[model samples]
Target chain A: MSKTIYIAGLGLIGGSLALAIRKAHPTYRILGYNRPEKSQQIARERGMVNDLTDDFASFAPLADIIILAVPIKQTILFLKELAQLDLKKGVIITDVGSTKQEIVAVAEVCFANREIDFIGGHPMAGSHKSGAIAADVSLFENAYYIFTPTQFTQERALTSLKDLFKGTGARYIEVAADEHDRVTSQISHFPHILATSLMLQTGDYAESHEHTKYFTAGGFRDMTRIAESEPDLWTSILLSNSRAVLDRIEEFKERLDEVAQLIFQKNEPAIWKFFNQGRAMRQAMEIHKKGGVDSFYDLFVEVPDEEDVVLKILELLRGISLVNLHINEENREDSHGVLQLTFKNAQDLATAEVIIKNNTDYHITIT
Target chain B: MSKTIYIAGLGLIGGSLALAIRKAHPTYRILGYNRPEKSQQIARERGMVNDLTDDFASFAPLADIIILAVPIKQTILFLKELAQLDLKKGVIITDVGSTKQEIVAVAEVCFANREIDFIGGHPMAGSHKSGAIAADVSLFENAYYIFTPTQFTQERALTSLKDLFKGTGARYIEVAADEHDRVTSQISHFPHILATSLMLQTGDYAESHEHTKYFTAGGFRDMTRIAESEPDLWTSILLSNSRAVLDRIEEFKERLDEVAQLIFQKNEPAIWKFFNQGRAMRQAMEIHKKGGVDSFYDLFVEVPDEEDVVLKILELLRGISLVNLHINEENREDSHGVLQLTFKNAQDLATAEVIIKNNTDYHITIT
Candidate 1:
């Protein structure tokens, strides 16, 4: 049966999902409210969606699937507004918000008497750029798309929503609302706070010590990179997810104190164990990347910091079509082997490796 | 004035310094003891050094300068051994150690009565790859080379040492031993410990939360990138600079708690101020980077994740001889503008910008 998928926001997440859904299910009509955003305007100009509506409330009731891809606070407001609307039967409403617990609570309260099922969503894929202009069909590809279900949520709603977002090529994980907040706080939200704190500390130190900023090498720079993110967005993320962020901060202090004591006592073995365990765990994380694919092979190449260097490497492997080539900003802490290339099969990777070695003087390390 | 410069431990730092020195002052006689490491062996085979030493103490008397590029603990031992050796007068000895206070204190005790000056050196540049084989002549190029001078160090020694290392192309900063330790702990050492702690916390959180590992996104992965660094090297660094690291941890906790309070209170303006300050500081640091040059212009291009995409951009700017093209892993937090290209003049950058705009659909922003 043909259905209307009404997307409420046309920012990065909303716009990307519209493109992904359209490509995934051409039968469904994608009706979205194009805000005054440049990304949304550009997407409309490109004819990404089936239709546009300024009257969100009137058109919202026609949506079989409503995606609230607004800010966390606004998502709550949308849920409230969406609750009173006369929606289609068996409609599944979801959101792409950063924090889930509060939104899920509001969702459960709003949709309790209604036939519609609201599932909290947090798609963990985005770039520094915002808006639909920066949106791509593969924005969430290989990234984690999480679902936090409420007591009112049914299996039919969950599975249908998952199928709809499947075109994104993302890995799906279901988590409880509070548990989701705790986990995200441990990973994303708290890390942002820490990065900001580190920068502030370094900046404070630099005020007294001249040229201290100049001494921060690759590692320090990498750790504090997230501090450069937009403050208003982060402020909302932190405020909305306060409990989890605070708990993470407390937990982080304990973990840090443990290592600090080990260093203070001059316990080399313990300190080594601390760093080595982290290294081992981080390496393990890499192996689990793209876990669903057995045929995909990863190739890491060490590129030097020179003009048109990466171009030179690609020039060597011109004939072979690669699946993906990401500059592993993570591995960039080291000066070598920063480019991580993905191939759908081993044969392509092998051919690319031989071509790089035979044609260029660059160091090729397969990790 | 062709003087023999003996460098002990041809690791990444020592080997790169030797190469930089040779290219800078071709007439200088460079002698170094190559270790049983692959990096050193490769450097030796490449004729990066003029002479090799089997017995460092026996060859110590003939050198005008010596650089101890061993591990921090080993550097302390080498300093002790060199002190007792009948050394050449006015011989300047320096060690490339992470922690300066401990090593500089050791140097003062060992070289107090001798005519040689033991000026502590820490070249704030290195890759994840250790050993001389991984060393490049431009390893320390455009990096900070810090000097921690003792009370007995004279103007003659400082100037001569600076002159000798001119080939490194590193900006020199003179900081006191205690201040050096404190500053580095704020920027590098403390951040390393924090990164490890974050990874360990995430791993532990994953134990109870199913699929938690799969949920960690780019931001989390980026903040913990340095956790993948070597254990043994970091262990020595943390131990040698225990006091400063401990102090930094205390200060960090306070800074973190301040934000925590503001977040808990839901003071959005205050929280925004905290993060905005960090963003401003981090941005300020970038402007100061390569501050010596007046003609340098930086261009940031937002490249999408596609196979051979960067190659396409480089193809557009083929005629422009860019001074540098660095893949900023830091900016990878954002989905766009990851490639940072440097041009010596505004004309080249403007030309490259036009070429990119005309040739491709990629977004370009001048920073």
Candidate 2:
């Protein structure tokens, strides 16, 4: 028996993982440890886990598996405390944090002679929303969950932990702690930094020119929505992952400057060509089959009279492969005997039109 | 009695406007004239307008409102031809194009005789998928429709046309043709260019590092979806709106450089403060009631058992002043429990999370 698993800091990422684990292994016992009475109450009320406790002594001793899903500073503090506490001898321990090298380094020093095993993990899943209330079981579905274990990491324990996340729809990848931080900084953290900058630029511009209110639309909204994320969390991410984030920011700046220089030269053709190259590269991205993760591509669509229409539209959309399709009849309706359809793909808009022209009286349009 | 309106180039925009006009004013005759025989056939078959024809000369003589809903190049050419044509006196000509200043400048020269007034109009409504086949009447609903006219523009004619556009769910705004182009270039064109560049960067990185395949998700997809937009249309937009687009691109690059410098210096606190400023600005923007033309803030949500749940949720959301909620449901319970709720404010996602927590049994989580 895998027995019960105890997760410290039952917040957004931690609570969500508990739900995911529950869904995948319904029979397994899951325990949560969090600060404040409300989070523990909400976790129990929401049935996010089987049990909750604030005491690390009692919780850590009876666990087959333990996960530290807390902030970097707190996670370090928790590791130090856990090093002194009485924990199950053969227990496997993991963590969910944005930065890995720092935490892993702390773990190495704290647990060197303590028989405690530490394997760092980072789930690429993120949202502007936060806290225990935001936790969902499907958060890790097919998301690229990475495990960073140092040379001293016990392979058997790491393998067992990896097995726990198997059916939770998260794909496991292994890398050095430093490399994980570096790669994620480039791909994830840097983008957030850039997105914040874009929003601030517009905000500064808006302060001076009142007319910006009338001008900025969907494009700006989508670009800046993530700007609303928690400030402290992002602060930690940037500070801890500064080196890698800065490197990627430089890469972005280089590209941006290239376009700026071309514009300064009044090279219209070159500018168009540059933008064209970007457009082509974007279009060529493999947007199909993201495998059950909470991907932005999973824009649920409402298409009325879905059964026949979905099949026909799917047939026409064979020209373009889509990652996932879920039909919601409530969001869509056949207005005046016209089947209204929505899709996640640009090509699907054309495909929907093709299907409508061939079969239904549906007025297919992209929203 | 308002006489028949003639729309040249019966493509998506023109055809849709013709349908909207007809729907809004059922008594008025809508005429569609296309140079392409196939498009003419499509227009007639789709009943896009009451009368469809290929002979522009014959139709031009009888038109009360002449809308140049054609390609930008052709729109200028037709304006020149209309300057010489023997048409109904006081016939107002309007255009539907992305860029306005160039067209208005050319129209100023073409229609030197203010008798045949050419007012530049752009309904910021379109789909990535377009053509005569995809044209529909309701495309302009709740969209931002702007009319850019010079000092010599006929005010009475502008009002008459505005009356015709009334009740189409499109709010009309007046702006200078040059200013319109400049502002949209920053808000619209620059974002598309930025998105394309970002996508290209991802592609280049992915080609070199296979690990990027796992990293790409919602944030990336939303950032790049517009990147996959019609390349040919973008080419035309970039070339025509070159000056404004280039200026905006430079502005974006400057901002990007600023952010890169901050990140490079590892200024974590500055990053947080800057991001928070943006967050507050974006949050304030959610107060706009009309939700603008590009459907920018009007994001729809779809979830299982979303109909009754979303309606009840909308009722709860109505108590909040920050967001405008619109929930469409006619079939009620007979309708599948799935609901599609469209929020006039993007910031409503945070609020909606609160509502979902209170009302829905189906676990609503975002991680």
RMSD of each: 5.7, 8.4
- Candidate 2 matches the true fold with a TM-score of 0.78
What stretches of model 1 exceed 4 Å from their correct place? A37-40, A287-367, B34-40, B287-367
Per-residue alpha-carbon lDDT of candidate 2 for residues B169-264, written as tens digits (9 for 90 to 100)? 677888888778777776677777777777777778778666676666666665566676666667667767878776776676677667667667
By summed lDDT, which 10 consecutive residues of candidate 2 chain A come out lowest?
A: A328-337
In order, what fnat does every candidate score? 0.62, 0.39
Model 2, retained fraction of real contacts? 0.39
Residues A177-259 of candidate 1: C-alpha lDDT, one tens digit per residue: 88888877887889999998998888888998886866676677677878999887888899888998999888888887788
Give the CA lDDT, 0 to 100, for residue A1 in model 1: 76
The deviation in Å at residue A301 for candidate 1 is 7.1
Backbone clash count, each prediction separately: 9, 5
List pairs with backbone clashes in candidate 2: A142-A169, A218-B296, A289-A323, A296-B218, B144-B293
- Per-residue CA lDDT of candidate 1, range B257-306, in tens? 78878988999999999999999999888723433212246888777655
Question: Which lDDT values do the candidates have, in the order given?
Answer: 0.79, 0.69
